[model samples]
Target: MLNHEVYHKFAPNQQYSYALSYRRQNVYDEKAPYHNEGVEQEFRLYGRYAYTFKLSERWKWKNTLRQEFRKFLLQTFTRQKRIFSLEPD
Candidate 1:
């Protein structure tokens, strides 16, 4: 699935603001031996932050930071093979 996200700041003097996000499931292959695009899943999230500081009346400095996370769940088609990802990074 795809999602559209937005954020807003209400305070006038709010030089610092932040937002968070979350999601689940990624790349769940549920196809047969014929390789059918029956069902698949994936998830991703990202966050960003910024801070404003004034060095002079006309000059201001802005610093920003960002972070993100991604997850995927790939299920096996056969009963013998186990289902799971090695690292969820």
Candidate 2:
């Protein structure tokens, strides 16, 4: 698997930020049941927003919201499935 991301800070105080990322994965198995002789591929695109604040002089709190778009493919690159997800942390 491989991933790359770019991030931007929206506030000079660094309280707000956003990022965009891309990921790719390759799977291999000899005894699996799906996708081109047990080999599969996946690709993903992600976007995230984050906010941070001070909880105390020595502590901080952060929250993040993320969205993902993903696709699965056979080893030959034929599309198999598409998925979308939203997550908060």
lDDT top scorer? 2
Q: Give model 1's TM-score versus the native structure.
A: 0.34
1-89 per-residue lDDT for model 1 (tens digits): 45655554445423333433333333334665544433334344655566667788999887776555544443333321233333334
Q: How many residue pairs clash in each candidate?
A: 3, 0
lDDT value, candidate 2, whole model: 0.61
- Tens digits of per-residue lDDT for model 2 on 1-89? 66677778877435333344444455545575634444456666777777778789899887877776666677677876543344332
**Can you give the TM-score per candidate against the true fold?**
0.34, 0.63
Give the residue spans of candidate 1 off by over 4 A: 1-5, 10-43, 71-89
Assess the local accuracy of residue 47 in candidate 1 as a C-alpha lDDT between 0 and 100.
Answer: 57
Lowest summed lDDT window (length 10), candidate 2 = 13-22
